[model samples]
Target: MSMLAGATLVASTLLGAGPASAARPPQAPAIPVAGLADPPAEFGTDWHDPLTAAPPVTHPTGKSCEVTVAEAQFRDFTPYKGTYAPPRGCGDRWSKVVLRLDGKVQGRQYDRLGYLHIGGVEVLRTSTPQPSPDGIEWSVEKDVTRYGDTFREGHDVEMLIGNVVDDTYTGIIDVKVTLTFYPAEKPAATKTATKTVAKAAAAPDHVLTLQDGTLTTPRNSERIVAEVYATGSGGGCEEYWYLTVPDAAPYSCKAGDGPYREVQIEVDGKLAGIAAPFPTVWTGGWSNPFLWYVIPGPRAFDIKPVEYDLTPFAGLLNDGRPHRIDVSVVGVPEGQSGWSTPVNVLVWQDAKSTRVTGKLTAHRAGDLTNSSTYTSGSEHRLDTGAGHRLTVAGYVDTSHGRVTTTVDRELAATSVHRWTDGESTDALKGTWTDDEKVTVDGHGPAVTTRTDRTYTMDGATTLGAGDRLRTVLSLGDRASVVETRGGRRTAWSRLDDSYAGDATYTANVPRDQRHAVGTTSERYRLYGSDGCYDRRLVTVQGTLTGVRDSC
Candidate 1:
């Protein structure tokens, strides 16, 4: 069980009845309080709730049905188990499905990690927020329409927020989750309506679970995708993997290979895909909970899974044989444990063909490059670099014709870490990039979709005079996607999410004497092809100071 999972807070003034109106013009989300005073000299019993600049889940109108997934109070490692059934009022077909989770906690507690699984399919991965003495409440929403097949039928549900409640930690997490389904609008003709319904629910025909790290797909599977919820946690050094140093370095956390880490997927001993995991900073990260009392670094409350397009391996997996599929992280000690990876496979099958046959045409892998150099001085330093590339191609016979899919992926990372003699002042600057291109032939003109993702981190924590500690941090998550057919651009999109924070507090003292003060902000901007969205949020001393939506 992982020690930390999460939540964030929203100001009472910023709370809305539902998703914001898209047509509304850009403006301040909340009016600034008149004559807002400076922060107090010491910590208080209460503060503003955690919040982010991320957009809310938009819903469609017509008719909707809702179902309660789970409701429980988590105080230990025990998991809440229940059963979920589709809503009766709404038909089997749904135009969109949205998931919402509301949680509240009070008293003293550390961040804990949690996950929600329906019928053995992982739907949401999250972490909890540390609460003030007066307590706090938060909510998060996600689009689970892609998991339509999982919710269409009754399934056993399981949820857990691993925690410990004793004399020192007293916060018990209370949460409730629900799913709302929007029915598709009626069309003029019955045949057209049938087609529209089918297209609307064209997510995946089958959702398969991994048993003992093995997978067996249907013989006629046409497209295959695997999503892995990989997290490095367990309240240990792995939780802060980026700060690890070589064994020779006199650091508290040491890794044999320094701080470069990558997540890789393998099928039957052959590498299938590789991805750079998002460096998540929990609510209590960087030895300071005050920095994240309001806005988390990035993707802290909601963890998005790393996805792999295994269509190139559909030919091999369609053999109807149990094949071993393994997920592993590259930079851990020989016999240590600190990572969790749970996988779910999504498949689309051919209606006409009972068996789809093909062969693996080509597979190429570039040598992995990894290097770490260390220097000892008043300011110890560690410089690290790593990268890898993989390309795979295969063809499968389908109802339409013979189809070929090729996938090319590349990942690279570089970082510079520095710290004092006793680790009084520790800092790091790092960047990771993952680039992928998928091309499919034999379906009209050849089409290709390319995606470029980049992640960054820059932060420093220092212990100064009078037991005073300060931390300054900045993080970024950026990506761009483009699609082209026959060398002509067809569509594209871009996203830039950034966060910055500065916090200070007196260390090694009672909660009431810590005298903590901090300010944090996040700006999320997404634009292209479909539309544009821009939002920024700022918080000072736990109070939401500003929220602007420029687009």
Candidate 2:
């Protein structure tokens, strides 16, 4: 299948856009259909019944798998693939779609899922039943009511049951699908109201505000925007500066081979902050742009936003004097590790806000090291650094609040690879692992902290049928914890967490095309009897794919 692009709203380019002024964003996906007061009727879709093939027990593996499978494709050079666009559909909608994958069908991995596409747009995703005692032989029912606007008559709908996680399996399977349509009893109606909050057009004589005006025009407020993206094919492991948070931690870069850590920030030539890992999935990845563009992950419903507590800096920038600011990144130009980054800084101001003017300190395409050689004979081995860091700097007054600022940055990563028959095809198969860790703390005029934090982000393109991508992680005691005044480690958790599963996404495209990539993000939370800490947040509106080439 082909690769999938985000909708118009998700992963949109912020460059040249003015400050966010709309009360209601145009990207919101709200369907017009009324909720079913009664069970709706089903419109029989198409499918192959009567057991075309044998179903899987714990699913199937490599050779045992039997089904029309899909795979993840690897890439080397960066193709200027623009963001994904949805297909133009008939003026109609559906409420639901029922997908049935019989037990007789075999697939590669259960962790990853297959995708269903309609008219070239992803409409549904299917799960597997392995490792789970029950739930096997069960069917998956998805609510497509939201995307009702994207459906039409004679729409080309197809199902893909294979994923990149199983290169070892030439899986096979059978599929069946059904759709439920709802005819509006009456035409839907919408209401719109606009409210504007007036503010003095003049800044306080004593207030000074400085923000990065690249992604978005300067804004007046206590808000910040940061990002990560690639501009080139990332020779090996690429790096780019995101933002400078006066100083702290929550991010890291890589050390060659693969995974890496946060980017460090410096203020006034001093270590200022560390970039924390916060995912831009919701902002960049959506289900269906127009209708059901919601996050597929229950936990990441795309609501748990990332923000840095810069209120403490409010008092520092009150001096009215212009300050200097600079940001940079590091890494190799390899696969989808990471590349050119764009950062937008927002420091809302009144009379209490000051200024930050500085030079772009030590900035360059860092030379990531590649040590620890791996021997790939009978069994392949890897021993190389996987992470690195970034540092942004600037000059500004001190926050009068002197009140400590508390912020958390979450980090994560995932990847897929395929080692050809250099040794044995299965000997060195592809793997994809995702991890989340955070480093939370506090910093300000009253309390400035210094620490060494880094992260290694792993990204890869979708796997083609027979491609392999498995998780490869070796965490140590979640050692991402810190020692506060009390020997107690604060619990870093998903505050609004509803789902914490593996990184999974599916799309339906041309059989000649490959889509779906693996990516990870991490976070940090401070834990002290008296809660308070500091950290920086960096998000990448970038692509997550390995080289678009095969092993």
Candidate 3:
């Protein structure tokens, strides 16, 4: 019987008259509270009273009632049905006990809460404090209380009961209470009547079915879906499974296996899945293929065969510029050899479109040379030798001798490309259509290269202007500006990339530091790699004067 029933029995036995005052109505059932008692082992063989005496009934109000009661609750089983991470709902069966005063209802509480084991680790506890108009029949309240505890296989419940009451006529009260055991609902192999009721009213948002021994969520529109998959029960045999909700309807539960039904599915604070009830939706599950994540790009390089010798080259080719060796290749997918025949080369600065290519020649295993190139923008050029040529976009840098060359356009080359003796002489091919932006050293070039061959390396000095210039200097990191300046020789304050106070920036070169320039002759150092005849040349001359970055 429910706890409220017991309260009504006591109240009816004492209040012989029909209910009167608004504050004191016919007694209502009370919620149970914690009542577990220490076992017989704690008391030993000593004989004792079956009922423990109730303490004096004391309240803030001076008036006192004549009777008292006590109650305890026990659980036969918990409600969890499967090994779920977060147990979804309450179990199928539950019962409670209540004790109350003979003629009045004081206060009540309930304990012995229980629920299912989730993931074989957590206990899902659920309780409902209900109210009833008729003392015999109970009505479930809308509000539900739930909690979790660690799951233990052989768990049981125990409690003790005691209470006290005072007499309204003499200020003296009698107390009597008993401990009772009620069978708890256990998880059944098949659904029970009560279980069916809970399922019909509180079904989860998902449902699952195993096909060919493989589990799959057929599809449903239920707002709350409960899917069950059985892995190895014990002894370590395990399996994996998943259920996907393709779509959702507000406050609805949809499933793959059945017709749409209204249900509520909540994950965290937000609605994760919902669907409309009745009238099945969607013919079948959507086809979503398994996807592989993109792998990380390469970090280091193994050299490719890249070299050219314009030893026998002639002047004045197609662009009116003197000819030299130019070579190029398209990006080949991993494990494939040779380049793609370009109908049109697509050059892109982003990592997705650009391809990296590198070549290194080794004198021996330990001693080697490395040249690497990153392709940028791509275009189509048909006039060279092949049907179409990909644009030459990125700069090529070699490590052995610091060989660097910037390719601005597509150069002409043959389609029958091959490496013989790990060496090839082919002119760089492709269109120069995207070479609109230019940078000297690392700094932006405000003026076009055509407008000024005299480029600023950093924001400090100028390079080639008057022939009698002494020391030329350029400085900056990769992203900013480069300046250069030079003038007739004088003991001028330091005025290059370094600050004026630097020892190298001395007001005058100390006698010991006079060898800073490392030059006494008029000869300039040929600043070219083994591949280029002449690229950059550094020189020194008489009458040095510091020229700042005016341009």
Candidate 4:
């Protein structure tokens, strides 16, 4: 039972060379410290860049996924009593797991799997939180814990994978359960088995020509070159041609008087004249480089290509590997209560077309549906994806129960969208009363009529260039700016509440401000000065910016 859950955690702590040691608990099941001298290993390689294509392994490229699982030690951080000590049975065979990549068993250690048929014993769950590339390490999700009580039999487990510290790519890396069991007992560990998996050969990249045609070879040939000759008659003209190759003697052509005779022809490789019955002659052969001759005149002629044997330009391969590009589109589907499902767009460069088909999600119509004092206007939400710029420009007509939303041609948002039935009530609605019009509590209908069927956005979402850290702040004329970190919204207040006055105002990005550079935390504060507090609401509305890498 202990091996089934806690053992993986313990093993991960012992193997990982990170903060896992400090973050791990002393009482936690001990990691089996033996047999690492010759343990198996693998690598998970993502061959594509996020802006160009999806991983060929998962797409139509038919390439297999490369797996790389590093053995690491945990650095326990939880506070402990007096002298810190390791947990009991730290070296006992506690668990075992078989690693699999794309359904293929890749690695395994631990006899429990073979003996008892337990699947998860050999697997080790990581405790170190994925760190940001900026060298800052922070755990986004809590480490998985093993339950000591269920030790007799082993359980199944999986470790999520991706560029833990990089937010550029989409989807988590998943190592599936394969091996059957792991010995909970500790033994002298030996490490050394697989160093790295062999990667596939890179493919060639062709350069597009001015006409859009890919240029794979040069236009010069050496075998046989065809020459053209033209002749004009009383009413029109006529022409004929053939191929020849001059291995040595400098090649030349001629018309009348020359071996090949004609009026307006070529001789010693020179044009002569133009005449009917103009027997324009040429040679058909191949040389290191091929050449062609053009005769002018309005005439009829038939010619054949001279087969050539020559060396063309050798082909070259692309030294740069094709990168995986992530593409996602988020918007609300028409006609739904909450929000529409978020649409995920996926495209593989090795495949045809950039159109992606995936799932979507929806959200609430109003920003504050739970607030009792205020009624929200019509609105919906949508997203393109993290670090991507998305602009949604379209009309929402809800009066007929049909909601039509067309995003701008260039906009791509990877987020959820909501739908509205198209209806809102304000002071114009008279009062809030049930259809019975009994006036309910005896008080007059509320002042503002709550409206529905409105349209709004899920707003803009921005994530850190590496850690996925995000913050969003929105502003409006009568509305104060509300800021949200992660998903929690911050309370709003004037930059300086002491100031008293009725003034018109606006917010602006400081000209000298280099908003997104060199820092884990970026700051944006609301400021209200002088008499700018009561009179005008400076609605400074804009999506969060500078979360992705520096532009």
| True lDDT of residue 387, candidate 2 | 31
Per-residue alpha-carbon lDDT of candidate 3 for residues 397-464, written as tens digits (9 for 90 to 100) = 21222221221211111211111111111111111111111111222322212100111111111111
The best candidate in terms of lDDT = 1
lDDT of 4 at 462: 25
Of the two candidates 2 and 4, the one with more favorable lDDT, higher being better, is 2
lDDT of 2: 0.26
Candidate 2 global TM-score: 0.32
Worst 10 residues of 3 by lDDT: 288-297
Q: Rate the local accuracy (lDDT) of all candidates.
A: 0.83, 0.26, 0.17, 0.17
lDDT of 1 at 270: 97
lDDT per residue as tens, model 1, 405-435: 9999999999999988878888999999999
The global Cα lDDT (0 to 1) of model 3 is 0.17
- Candidate topping TM-score: 1
Worst 10 residues of 2 by lDDT: 6-15
lDDT of 2 by residue, 1-551 (tens): 11111011110111111122111112212222331122112101111111100111111112211112122221111211212222233123211222223333333322233445544434443333321111122343333332333343344454544433345432333344444333322232432212111211111111112344212212223323322221211212231211110012111222343433344433334333334343222112212111111112221211111112233333333334343433333233234444323232334443454442222223222333323334444433433333323323222232332222333333322222223222112111111112222222224222222222222223222323444222221111011222232234322211111111122222344222322222222222222222322221111111111111110
Q: Point out the higher-scoring one by lDDT: 2 or 3.
A: 2
